[model samples]
Target: MAASSAVEPTSFDPSKAYKEWEVNGKYFGDGREVALLDYIYNHPDIEQLRGNPEKILRAIDAFAQSVTGLINIGENKGVIVSDVIAQHKPEVVLELGGYIGFSAIMFGSAMKRAGGKQYYSVEKSPLFAAVATSLIDLAGLRDTVRVVVGTGAEGIQRLYDNGLLRSQIGMAFFDHHKPSYTADLKLCERLGLIGKGTVLVADNMILPGNPPYVEWVRASVEDKRAMDKAAQEKGNPNLQYNSRFVKSFEPSGMEDALEITECLGIEGA
Candidate 1:
């Protein structure tokens, strides 16, 4: 494990909690996703939701609150990343997970407003991607947000091979399989998809921490080189990073954190 980057935790208001997620077995993919689509389309304000990102987000939140909990960034941590998009003004952004397009609609709208060109969301499940695509279209962000159905590595490879990601990615958000974080990031680094000025934001850092990822990003070039000798997923050891931790809450009112790192360019480049 790496030395932890610390931040003050924000107090959560219990009154704002969503319907708790499944306790025993499944938390997602048991028809609730399609139910979300039905809920949104059947919403009385469906007409008003069209072309309105914020309203669409509100509707999603409504469903999560009254219906069932959703695994999403939600408003709290979402605002934190949204602020980063506004400040950094990334030209193109890549997202490892697209679950239901909540973050896509939220962050995609922000990116478009900031004059960004593209937002690619890679989702592993075709069913999940379908739901996300429908919602993204409903949000009128079809042009800016493109959902790719594949695992993180596969999607990155496809995009890069197709020339869609010919240049370095401006920013990347990791919220997929907890174990895939370091591997997918290494894939990006190996493919030159990340470089100087690229911003990396990883979710679920506290809820279920990712130690290897945190250590890699915060490590010095020399340290990383030594670490890579035993690593199967070899990343660019010389890519310098400055990282920090940010404390925020989940929609379910549970505590979580995001590891935010910025590439400072390759050492001695």
Candidate 2:
């Protein structure tokens, strides 16, 4: 009989290649995102804190768990939205969808880093609001970030009632239902929540595209161009309008992930 060679052990370490596998798998692989988020939430360093630290850590954990565990686990749109807010260092932030406060934490963290900023998240789901409120309290951001339970439109009225609209809102994030994006934008405009140089970011623009809203923006840009042309024809001052779409894709193994589209509103134009 021929001598049999010793079989080498398979070196398939899940943790070592987890990220590669995750991206290749297209953001869907046995709840990997959820597991990772849970790990972060339940980390020992975050758990062992006392007083404010402990509360903040708990809020962070709750928020992560609420989004990844309860809502769609593959929804990683928060990354892009959070990154934009963090980079801009906005003084005031308004988020459309609170969703267990995951995005709220990201915004709050960004605001904290930027210094002297506050975030107000509006969530329609009462359950999510409850969870988020608890998490916000735990995260010790009760002073910096406020979670309001209601849609943006409804919350706008409440904000006015509470005298919160006086502060200039620098950034706005839209992550609620796709159909509500345009409506919410209009609502914000009517309520004067967005200023001239305000930054408005909409997530999932491609995967779950909002055709009406997208078309509206296109038409508005065309109208602005026409206005500028008409002004030039009449020897009147031509004001230029700026509009651009930023395309961002979340790295996930799944084919359908998150897409972030940002639109900047020029005040005087």
Candidate 3:
């Protein structure tokens, strides 16, 4: 019910000195992902990383701090999601965008500890998905986490069609293409992937801001119905939601926020 920073550490530890994510004309989709693989695989403590999730996370954090910057959730924001996973005890967790598997490993480890089932990381880029898969495996989460290479829509449809995601999604983490957040969520709704007690955690809400996604999640069923008249994504307007905003910080000490939404159930048509 309270904001994310309410329970977590509000201050980013500057002493950690995590390298800022490389930002030129582009933020990701460069050679950095593969390079990260190289860095991890080549680390001196390679053997220690084989089956240690927390150690692997620490190593990755070290790489981000001293080596090339990575666009990962980092320890700061990652801990927030991990804590939610602990409290919610979701049977299955879905990750929209897993660039090199940082969030996947983090949340997957949490899922495993919480006695959850699976963690699905849907990445648009095959290259990134491959990297994420390798890292997740290295973290000993190969059984707990699976990486799917495709757009959010494709991944959702594939999993649903395959009956892997037919059950209600206990918790979904959205960190993919910002614009697709609402569309992808709508797709999930249309497919009945969301139900009572389902939780949706959307990242990068404050830094880049997702007004449309936020509006949709927070809107009343009547308002959503009105919007659906002209919307391309015809989600279940009758579905009810209780939403809130959680303030947090980037690993690099930048300000950001996460929008958490829980499905209350279907409202009257």
Candidate 4:
């Protein structure tokens, strides 16, 4: 890995604690996503939500706050990625998860505003993907975003096989299975989806730390090469990365952070 990137600003206010009901529990797949859609579609301000990402996001936030809590990359952490998008101006943004299309709509809107072409939200659950597609279409971003239903690796391969993601992936966002973060990233590395100038944003660093993924991104190139023999997957050890830990608040008001890693270049090429 390359030298770590310097964290910025160095100033942050105390974030409010999440409401007791705001944190997620073992209550997914109970049609909460559908309830969110119902709430949005039935709102008196539904007309104003059309083609309005902000309003749509507000509606989602409203559902999460007033209703059941959703496990999403909430407004706080979301802004961090949007700032990254503004700086990188990636032509395409790929997300490993798209729970109910919250992050998809949020970041997809940012990508479009930044003059990017596409934002791909890959969700393994077909049900969630369907719900996301409906919400994304409702946001009138059907052209700017697409929801792929499959595992992260499958999603990458499907896109690559179809030639929609042949060149370097401008940005990759990881917010899926905690343990698979490194494995999925390695798959992308193997497929050459990630390259120089690529930005990788991974969620759930503090709340549920991922040492393997963080170690891989923060390791020295020589260290990575040495560790390659013990790895289960064969990612390019030569891909140099510059990582930074950006602290932020989870939607539940719990302290969390995103690991923003940039592929500076391949090492010893």
Per-model TM against the reference: 0.97, 0.64, 0.94, 0.93
What lDDT tens digits, residue by residue, belong to model 4 across residues 156-254?
889999999888888999999888899999988988988999999999988888999999999988898888878878888999999998888787777
Residue-level lDDT tens digits of model 2 in 215-238: 444444445355446432221112
Off by over 4 Å in 1: 1-5
Poorest stretch of ten by lDDT in candidate 3: 1-10
Best by TM-score: 1
- Compute the lDDT for candidate 3: 0.87
**Is candidate 2 or 3 superior in TM-score?**
3
Candidate 1 Cα deviation (angstroms), residue 161: 0.6
**Highest lDDT among the candidates is held by which one?**
1
| Regions of model 2 farther than 4 Å from truth | 1-46, 49-76, 221-252, 255-269
Model 2, position 136: C-alpha lDDT score: 68
Residue-wise lDDT of candidate 3 within 1-269, one digit each (tens)?
Answer: 11232234388788876776766765667677777889889989999989999988898888778866777878877888888899888899889999889899999999889999999999999999999999998998999999999999999999999999997889999999999999999999999889888889999988899999988998888888899998877998888888878888887888888888888888763
**Candidate 4 local Cα displacement, residue 37, angstroms:** 0.7
Clashing pairs in 1: none
TM-score of 1: 0.97
Give the better candidate number (1 or 2) by TM-score: 1
> How does candidate 2 fare on TM-score?
0.64
Which pairs of residues clash in candidate 3, taking residues 3 or more apart in a chain or in different chains? none
